[model samples]
Target chain A: MNDLARTIEALLFIAPEPLEVATIQDITGEGPDGIAGALEEVRGRHGPDTGLELAEVAGGWALRTRGDLAAACDALRARPREDRLSPAALETLAVVAYLEPVTRREIGRLRGVDVDSTVSSLLDRGLIEEADRPHAGPTTYRTTTAFLERFGLARRGDLPTLERFELTGPEAGALRARLEHADLIAEAETGDA
Target chain B: MRGTNPAEGRAGDAGNLGGVPARDASAALTQEVEIDLFQGPFDLLLTLLLRDEVDLLELPLADLVEEAVTPATDERWEIDAASQLVLLLAAIADLKGRRMLGEEVEDEPDADALAMREALVGRLVAYAPFQRAALWLADRLRAAERPRYRRVPPGTATPVPVHDDPARLSAAIDRMVVAPPAPSLAHMGVVRRPLPELLVRLRDSLARLREVSFDRIVADCDRLEEALTLLAALELVRRGEAELRQDVPFGDILITGTRA
Candidate 1:
């Protein structure tokens, strides 16, 4: 059991991206059942109560600092203060991040605001770039390597939970809750677990 | 009595004739009834506010409600009605505190509202930059265009069609669109060739052969699929059907039939 834990920890530490159970199995040469058990044990050892915990993100698992401790991590790293994202930029970024490889026209329609400029800023800041455009009029944009680097992510798949930054005013929260509930149902149908 | 009765009857007739016609009444009803301006409630509201030129800092909610229901503003405009209304609603909400409490209420705008306004302004400001970038990109894209079907040069062998008939080939291409073939491992796999054995056979074959151009041995084989042709050459060397010589720089290979 100790050996399994050590092996799992080592694999997680050196992994380029988050590891799935199947990936862990491949690396450790362990059976699925054994890997699943080991992962569960590791997760149990690092509960939410602790400074570090296991998080499931983008259909894979990674060891992450607790949400509450994010500020501390930021301080410890002495990371430069980032410019506050404007609502438009945030909205545009969210749309691009979630439905990535999306075109400017589609994003504009979604936000009810022209996104050409927002996309330019994002591109200029190396947060987004023109992905190959389909045979369509407008070219598509996708998040960039710098976006991941700025956010301390190895890839786009390392985005934190969408729930964290959801609009939560009275009217917005009510609508969001219903939408989230529907999302939960959908997730259950197609969840990785 | 006869004169009085006629005068009274004339007055009654005049009053009855003064009533509106049924068609005109229906028309009036239709004209007065308000239709929702746009699909999005928010965009419709913004349009109303913008049309009225109402300052965001002095939003008149009651007047807005009245204007929203007015039939005069129900006509479809150039911009999407829904989006207009959404923008109006956002502006109104943003200015709600200011409008209701006076400008000197020692209040700052809602952080989100201020952020949104800044972003919108930023987008407007960056329009020129986006246009410049887009124009540059468009020129680059135009310059990058290549001929769809490059003509095969004369004297060069026409490559064998992967699929024979054009119609069948097009259909196969369409099927590929729907379902792309998975990458095959055939190209990635390592092939073991005993170089020492090959060299020994080459020496043995050369002992009994006369010099020939290197091209003569591979003349019939496809140049692109070099692996298969090289394997065949190795096999020929092993069987004493070909020989390799160091006598020439580029034209070093020779072939001889065992019987010859």
Candidate 2:
């Protein structure tokens, strides 16, 4: 088990991007149960003593700079902007990413704003692409692989959950509950009546 | 890859070194700017904010917004590019005013204020991830990227069939209608052999045999002629001169001459 854990640790350490348990299993030929146990062991190995973190991002395991050191590692992550997208462009991109194979008209409805300039900018940037529609309806857009890489995501399915962000109806109830929980925590900390 | 601290600075260095793999041939037709001066107003503000490291909540967003918008106040500002930023400013003002005013009205907190804050917060929360994504993309773009020129000349796209001019589109449809109705199977003209002739051929062939296989009869014929023969055979069977038998539906059909 320790040997398996060590091997998993080394693989996770060297990987540029996150690796899935299945990918590790393919290489190691371990069952999912065994792989999960080994990963747990590997996670234990990356405890308080080390700066390297064995964390799951986008449904895969990756070695990232530990959260405590994120501030110090900003320089490592920071890179110059060549051609950046504006907030509207970025919002349009988010809409396209969340609701992929999405029509421009549909995106317009979701954003409640015109997306003409933003759509063209995304096209020029190679971030989002015009997906071919089988029927001659409005052209739908999908995020390119370039988009996944740009966002540091392994796949489109790895997009961060937007239901909470939508902050609508039932999701608002969840948010309210979350606020109540925070209030409880605050009350506990204050020792107030 | 060895027992080294491979965490120093190799985030996105592996891929095509920051080059705009322009592989787009038709891009030449569109006048391309060498480098975008700035992506737009929001990106400009983000770049400014990223450079300054100002705390978003504490910082007066209105000042930065005013500075950004002031240039555009004359004939300079683009409505498309800067409208969202202005709206953002309005939201910021609303939030700031609410924060100041709503604190005093703690006894009866306004629902509108909370809702406005939630809306703005939600947008910012949503916008934050994309901003980070844009930054990453921008970084990748900054890395040693060279635009690849196209080797082959770009082919002209077929003219768009749908046009705003209804007359022109209808004229195009009219032209299509007028043009020699698609030369259409004319070169291989139809050869309609009489059904009675096929019936006579079948009668002569099946006279000795108790039964004849439909496939074997049509095996030597071309597709069109073979189809005609099959139809003629079916017609003969329908007329009761021959009986059709198949052990299984869709299996090989057998046509036997009726003794009667």
DockQ of each: 0.01, 0.03
Q: By TM-score, how accurate is candidate 2?
A: 0.34
Q: Write one digit per residue (lDDT tens) for candidate 2, span B35-117.
A: 12222334333333334443334555545544444332122222333333444445435444544554321322258745755
Residue B11 CA displacement from its true place in model 1, Å: 63
Alpha-carbon RMSD, candidate 2: 24.5
> On residues B72-172, what C-alpha lDDT tens digit does candidate 1 reach at each position?
43222222232333343344554455445554321233577447555644443333233333333334323322101112223556544644798898898
Tens digits of lDDT, candidate 2, A91-131: 77777877789988887765667888889888988988988
Docking class of 2: incorrect
For model 1, residues A114-140, the per-residue Cα lDDT tens digits are: 778888888887878888865767688
Q: Highest DockQ: which candidate?
A: 2
Candidate 2, clashing residue pairs? B17-B144, B18-B143, B18-B145, B19-B145, B19-B146, B72-B77
Model 1 CAPRI quality: incorrect
Candidate 2 chain B, run of 10 with poorest lDDT: B22-31
